[model samples]
Target: MATIFTIPGSLRSGSSNHNILKFLGTLVPDGINYTIYDSLATIPPFDPGLDNDTTPQPVAELHRLITNADAIIICTPEYAFGVPGQLKNALDWLVSSGTLVDKPVALITASSSGEYAHPSLLRTLGALSANVIEEACLLVPFIRARIQDGVLDDELKEQLESAFESLLKAL
Candidate 1:
């Protein structure tokens, strides 16, 4: 079975990012193992010195997961008009490791006026050499209100569903 991993950029419980992941999980078809990485908080600061054969346990674990997954989905909300610090830190650890290099990734910037963060994150992913699927990426502005509507709104639901399906196709 194919495996797909999701990483929510927000650390807050019940965050719109997490909820988005949960909603996507429901759309996972059979013969696919969908997993959500919920340990972003555990990823320590990016220390180039510490990133080696004896890397931090949390960083190693995250690396292992990303390496094993067939594809990656990163859904995040911008903070102070930029990518969240923790999420950026996590990506930093992967820079030297090249864990995301050539990996199929789908990015979703779901926030109020996500314009700034969305492009910034795309650049970061590009720097990682990640194969970010263009069709799979989305910038969802005013995401909280959309999440509240949830499955009720056919258009938004279809859009989110299409993003996930696009990722699956990329794999």
Candidate 2:
């Protein structure tokens, strides 16, 4: 079975991005294990000086999870025309650790105007040497409007399903 580690950029409970990730979990095909990494808030700010073997417990846990996963899906919201600080920090922590190198990743920017963060996130992941699947990377603009009461409309659901299928194929 393939394991997918999903990371939502928002820290707020019931956020659109988080809810979307949860929805995707339900759409996973048989033999695929989907898990959401809900500890972004628990991870302390990245500190290069303390990035050695004795890193923070949360950081270590994050690394372990990503390392164990067969693939990764990052669903994020744009914050002030950029990636969320917490999510960026998590990536920063992985820079020197080589945890994401050559790892299959699918980037989904789900926001009001996801355009800004989409390219920026791709560049960041590229710098980390992640095997970003271009076909699977998607910009889900106006995501809040596409989902209501934790449910996605048919159009959005179809789009997300296509992206998910591309990710699985890439893996």
Query: Candidate 2, residues 19-101: lDDT per residue as tens digits?
Result: 88888898888898999988999889999999997799999999999999999999999999999999999999999989999
Off by over 4 Å in 1: 149-152
Deviation from native of the Cα of residue 46 in model 1, angstroms: 0.7
Q: Which number leads on lDDT?
A: 2
How close is each model in CA RMSD to the real structure?
1.3, 0.9
Model 2 TM? 0.97
Task: In model 2, state the lDDT of residue 7.
Answer: 96
Assess candidate 2 and give its lDDT: 0.92
The lDDT values for all models are: 0.90, 0.92
Give the TM-scores of the predictions, in the order they appear: 0.96, 0.97
Give me the displacement of residue 36 in model 2, in angstroms: 0.5
Best by TM-score: 2
Residue 118 in candidate 1, Cα distance off native in Å:
0.7
